[model samples]
Target: MKKVKKIIWLIGLIYVFCAMVNGDAVISSITTEAETTPIEDSASYLPDKEGKENKITDPNNMGDSKKEHLDSEISSGHIISQETLNKIYEQNGEKVAYLTFDDGPAPGVTPEILDILNREEIKATFFPIGENVKKYSDITKRIYEEGHDIGNHTYCHIYKEIYSSPESLINSLKKSDEILQAVLGERYHFNVMRFPGGSFGDKLAPFRKAVNEAGYSYIDWNCITGDGEVISAPTDRLIETLKKTSQGKEKLVILMHDSATKATTAEALPDIIQYLKDEGYSFKPLSQIEEGY
Candidate 1:
């Protein structure tokens, strides 16, 4: 009977040892799998300043050091008041030209434009549509790096969608700002914006108020290149339009497009810069004007 009890105890001990080894093996397999499995790239959905959530696709995976550097470069300039903006718009004093390009960061066009501006040693403002910013993030980054001011032109730039209501316009602006932050880092913010198709007339009155309330100062062009008036307008026509519209304007907010289709604008830019220089008008980024206020 004692021998039988001993045998049973030995059997129980072996069973317990085997169970312990099997448990360890299971845990080891699980840990290895966890380590080896690839994590899928998922959208980091985050809320914007307006408490609205937006899905930002971060292509660069910008590091903290780079972000800090960018933040350091950005200046927290004072927001221009309505009265000050009106004063600037009234063409009160200095003969300054604010060259603003809209609807871009185009693949071929924007880089070419940047090159021209670089050669001329002039800085301008670029109002890039959010969708374009995502598609051509590298160009967008280049614009910021090259010391140009950037403004939000809206996410999709669809007129009916954004113009349906004041709330709709505000939401679109917020979404565009989120997209800009995704590419340019969280510290970057555009205090100034230009409404698509110009923020003029009583139709946009509500939107104008909403935009100001949402912490943005909207700018309208007193002059245009008319590059967007026709599909791929001739370089001569663009130059002529600019000259005609800019006549008698001491302070010019010159509107132009830098979309891929508007290559002629790039071609005509050198002449435009020269013409402005000849006309005794100094080129300045829109931000510079705002900063004065």
Candidate 2:
């Protein structure tokens, strides 16, 4: 009976030892699997060699920093007031320039300009012709989507038709404005107008009054690359013209065209931008000036 009892005790000891070994094996397998498994979902939470997780950059992934400034409550798609602008000039004396493009959304030239602008993170104003907007609506949409301001530059663009009289000019503006509204949808509103030639000329006085009274402002450029006047101007010539015309102006509204024929403008743009930078002038969209009113 003593031998039988010792045998039973030995069996119990063997059983306990086997169970302990199996339990350890199971735990080891689980730990190895956890270490080897690829964490596909989130790497940010997992421990690194330093035992610290990686920092998640841009959690919300709001890519555009411009959206914040444009969507701000203070100033959306409008310009700073002339008085405020003057005050800024008086205080800081920093040269400011508005880079205005007219007759744009052209096939090759417009997109190239947009790409350059995006790369540089600079903003400009586009005064798309109504006819061109209808033809290249997608590019027009791209212009606004990329945070540039748009103004009405008349639909027909025929000076004889659009510039016939005050009534004619107003009608042309409305037509152009409608096209912009249609393309941009209901939320987009542009209360700025640029005459077919300019806001000057005796023929535009009453038309200007009507537009101004109707809560629209007309803009005229003080400096130009003369791209419109000189169709085949070379890239260097365009840059030279820009530098020469904008030499002494403290506040300059530069008139540049983005028509298909104005490929030289796109070519000269980089140098022109650098010149502006070198001259201590900051680029601003027309909206900043328009909003102040």
Best by TM-score: 1
Q: What tens-digit string does per-residue lDDT give for candidate 2 at 167-245?
A: 7878888888788878887557767778778878776778777767666777788898989897769998888888899
What TM-score does model 2 achieve against the real structure? 0.70
Question: How many residue pairs clash in model 2?
Answer: 10
The C-alpha RMSD of each candidate to the native structure, in angstroms, is: 12.3, 8.8
The residue-by-residue lDDT of candidate 1 on 1-293, one tens digit each, is: 99999999999999999999999999999999989976446434446788777645342465787555554656433365555666676544678999999999898899999999999999999999999999999999999989899998998889999999999999999998898988988878767888999899998999999999999988888889999888798899899999999999898989999988999999999999899999999988876785544
Candidate 2 regions with alpha-carbon error over 4 angstroms: 1-92, 290-293
The superposed Cα distance between candidate 1 and the true structure at residue 42, in angstroms, equals: 29
Question: How many residue pairs clash in all the candidates, one count each?
Answer: 0, 10
Alpha carbon deviation, residue 205, candidate 1 (Å):
1.0
lDDT of each: 0.87, 0.79
